[model samples]
Target chain A: MPERSRAHEWTPITLLPLNGGPDPARLADSFLTPTSRFFVRNHGTIPIVDPDAFRLEISGMVRQPLRLSLDELTQRFPTVRRPALIQCAGFRRSELARVRAIPGELPWDEEPVSTAEWGGIRLADLLAAAMPDDAARHVAFEGCDDVEREGRRFGFGGSVTMEEAARHDVILAFEMNGEPLTAEHGWPLRAVVPNVIGARSVKWLTRIELRPTASENYFQRRAYKLVDRAGATTDAWEAAPAISTLPINTLICRPRGGERLCPGPIRLAGYAWSGEPGGVAAVEFSVRGGAGWRPARLSEINLPGCWREWTAEVDLASGRHDLLVRALLPDGSAQPADPAPLWNARGYMNNSWARAVLEVRAD
Target chain B: MPERSRAHEWTPITLLPLNGGPDPARLADSFLTPTSRFFVRNHGTIPIVDPDAFRLEISGMVRQPLRLSLDELTQRFPTVRRPALIQCAGFRRSELARVRAIPGELPWDEEPVSTAEWGGIRLADLLAAAMPDDAARHVAFEGCDDVEREGRRFGFGGSVTMEEAARHDVILAFEMNGEPLTAEHGWPLRAVVPNVIGARSVKWLTRIELRPTASENYFQRRAYKLVDRAGATTDAWEAAPAISTLPINTLICRPRGGERLCPGPIRLAGYAWSGEPGGVAAVEFSVRGGAGWRPARLSEINLPGCWREWTAEVDLASGRHDLLVRALLPDGSAQPADPAPLWNARGYMNNSWARAVLEVRAD
Candidate 1:
């Protein structure tokens, strides 16, 4: 049984089953999310692992299988630090869930994502020592968390393409925001995969496998995959490709729904990024419902696979307004104008145009 | 002797002498500033008062002088609640302080202000019973706090015009955010003069004096006044009229100065208000050094003598740029484009155009 812990201070307006993100008002305070304020996304009970007894085993299609303890792993490899923004595949799932009765995953609304400074040994460095052949096309990671589904027990697992694992930015992070990971966010070891959907960054990591194909674990095989909007059968599950990168996306942090706004200048702030090669190129806002768009000022630093912060100031008059945000990606693709066309089971990859209806009163 | 109390939770970024305001980011979270996050502007030590023994005495230019206990005060008059934003005249004084050596006052920045829900007996209600004479032109409020300066002991004091005090919004507040005031925030009662500088909202209830002219108390006569920037002499201090209504102004809450921003959409959020009769009419933003300006979306509720929230989304590319915000009052006056014209010796009333230099990097 998973042990219950004291409540976290960073929990925002939460949804059910342990999914919450920091309020955007607080998120905009700094460039990096402090450990106390970082978002927590957990699918199953949090496992309490003793770091002294923890070991990460590397096997599957490698020249030499090795088991390395936490201390040994740290002392043996050169550590590298990188900053990345990890967004959940189900981010903005709340928008989709609103369109229909999409069941299964936790309904998220721009809170399942956060940016952090990660430090760890490069996964590629260890893989090179183990010497995988050309047949090794993917890398799979498994965690100690036991998630029960339909009375069957299985561990949380995920995989990424070999090319992704080889990137210098992809690290096996042990330190989050310059400190050891907290138990709530995979204390001992976890993979920090940048620019990809958060599900692939498996937490509480216990094993790494060099494989000829993607892992067949429940999450890798059936879950976190993009499927047809109408398909809910086994055949559809078997044929769909696993969801990997995030689509061009934007999230409105201010002027949240149901808020009473005064008539004057209001600030619209949010985060935007993409999984495409060049990342998010531009983010724009439209006060009118898709009729006009104004470019939001982007941040100066645009790292591949990272979300950049943007800001703009617009004058608002007394009335209700539909504030819209859209992102232009490096691949020239943009968020769809409407989410109804992309609705799918499990509410995954619901990156449609982001809008907030604001009430501007002139009291 | 002054009382030392436990630290307060609502203090903003500070310079010295213990004056602070709400963080704009936190202030933007909701319409009302939480009690724990409200701004504190203290020139001297906070007084520890026994609420049971607290009495507010009303005298001077009235038909019948009256002294009422906390209990009697509550029972005799109807309690009213009002939501108002209180801002220090020195808000954004740092912008002016940066221009030159403006000494004596705490070096304030983009804080020194906050909005709160205050509940108390209206001064008007109590005064109606006292029946003020025709000679009363101003109402002076004196506090129990003993502030020592130049080896003389005197309490903090200020006054408003008789008509101003007669307004319904002016209250002897005993509760903040639905709870009794904290020790740090003038526990038993404090005068809440709406749409005025915070100094006028004297903390720590003691005595109210009706007078034929504005109070000659040191603060009312020598401090909290507008003076020419070049006037640093006693002559300048002697000639200037005490500062009264706040001018139209705006503040930038997010993208705080000296922050690292990435390339993408950024959100500019802030608070705006005018002490003039009609309140804030509009707030505009400029990135091209005031060559062109864009309007920000204002919140719907625009209360008189209170600040309204505003937001705008502007697209920005990678580079260093200056962002500016200005407010337009209902009376057709706008914020000065440059702050240099408003610089003063005490750094009071520094409501020039608010500008923040942001570094937009493409890392």
Candidate 2:
């Protein structure tokens, strides 16, 4: 196991942890997470590395394999900065736990995600220099941390197809919010594959390999795979494709669950996101179980690969109300109205409509 | 003059000094400015105050004239947290500099504004405890920072109607972003009146008084006024009313001035805000100089009293494109199409449509 290190530590808040489902009650008026309040998700022990000695290796099917130091990586390539969102694939996995009472890993509440301005060199630029052959189909990433789960030992590893990795959006991010990466996050270096599952964007990244075959690591093959329960058959994990782009999803960030609102025009606010390159196309909200849908006013600020905020004003006539928020992707994809449809064995990628309950008072 | 602090002290990017108009090319990606990057517009010097020694005096027409230290204030009332956007009445004032080139005052770039999560005691709760009579018309706020500008010595002061101050949105904020307020950003305490001009939400707030009349301070009476240039006028400052709620406005933040993009799908992002209680209703973008307007995707997240972010995706054929963004308030009020229609002598309150240019290449 990698030596555990505390890179970035923040004071904790006293709010109750909502299951893996997002608690709309915790969102503040500003869309950005306050530094101390940001959620954390770690697959393995955080690694401590000396920045001066840190090196990133680009190997595998490249004509010229290269091991470049941190200084050389930044100094040699043109630096680019952009805002991106990094979200755990099982962000609300705990919600599945409540539905089936099934056991799973990472008992996360509504935290485990964050967005920031990441500065780094483009991975496409780096790969261009190494010149991988056309036959290379996937780019695999390996982090320094090691994990032991249920008598199985494995290093943190994942892979993305080379086509997605070569897109201009991917980067070898080394800095968050203008400073070097914090330890809790992958310090020194990390893979930032925009609009992809957070698991594939390995932190504490040490190696990048261009391979004709996809990664056969446990994380890639066994853990993150989705299976069919009705078929009553066990298929090899390799048969399943790796989760890439996120689906259209929304989470109510205010009025939280089990909260009350004064009877009047109450502002309903939440965040919506999609991994499709076209961005969020639309968001419709309903206070009455999708009986009537009203278009929400979407935030104008677009931070690349980050979630977009949206809000709607609904008048509650002194009663119990169920507020639901669902988003549409640029490709016309909308979140499933119910979570039960997407429930799986591992509790992964649950992109369902987010609902909240608010008791409204006339006074 | 108050201490003339150098602008952009902590930022890596060199901000172009405020001129008469926005360059159209210098837009940033995120809507909120980093604290170090936020533009400062001071009519007086920043008052340095020791937090331990700070006291807020609440007197005038109230039955009880209360003097409370910062600690006493926190302990005495239930703390409330809200996100608010504080905009200078003169934000984007330089846009007025384009048409008439008005003289005097700092040449503010389009900035002169910011938003933050403020934690403090509710003004409504405090005013209720003070037992003010119904006869009170206005509640005035005074800041500790005194200023000498244009041969006049004045303290930053403003007033809101008694009914407005009694609303739940007004707060005497002592903390910003989960930390005690920074020295430069009115440490110890400040007043936050959502949707109002920044002038009314007095920073370095020291005193609150109930009055039968409005505040007659120079900032309230002479400056921050809107004028009708088309009509006959005597003194340029006399005909205008004190600036209050901001009009519906939008700003494009990315593909910053002079940035290039390849011909394909170009994603445009920006922020929109209004001073009224209702959120922004809609945002429309155009790439052909208002020839055709398309609705941009708005973020679902809406923090109370905070700016809303919006985004749009456009497929651009290879060439130079002029992009324009306009916002509409919840009341269906849209910003004027051009600054020419909204120009005033003092160069204040320019809420014209924001525009930008991008050159797309085939590569």
Judging by DockQ against the true structure, name the best candidate: 2
Q: Please give the lDDT score at residue A39 for candidate 2.
A: 54
DockQ of each: 0.01, 0.02
TM-score of each: 0.51, 0.52
lDDT of 1 by residue, A188-213 (tens): 88999987889888998999999999
lDDT of each: 0.78, 0.72
Compose the digit string of candidate 2's lDDT tens values, residues B1-363. 121232343322222222122232222423454344544555566678866778898888999888888878888886655457777777776777778777764556555566655778889878888889778889999988877655877668889999789777789987765446665667677888988888888888989899998887777766777765534354566546777877777767776646878888877877888877676879998899888999997764454566777878899998888898999877777889888877776777788988887888877
Q: Which runs in model 2 stand beyond 4 Å of their true positions?
A: A1-29, A150-152, A230-235, B1-363
Question: How far is A292's C-alpha from truth in model 1 (Å)?
Answer: 2.1
lDDT of 2 by residue, A191-304 (tens): 888788788878888899999988877788766777534232335555766677877777777778677667788887777888887678789988887788889977644445
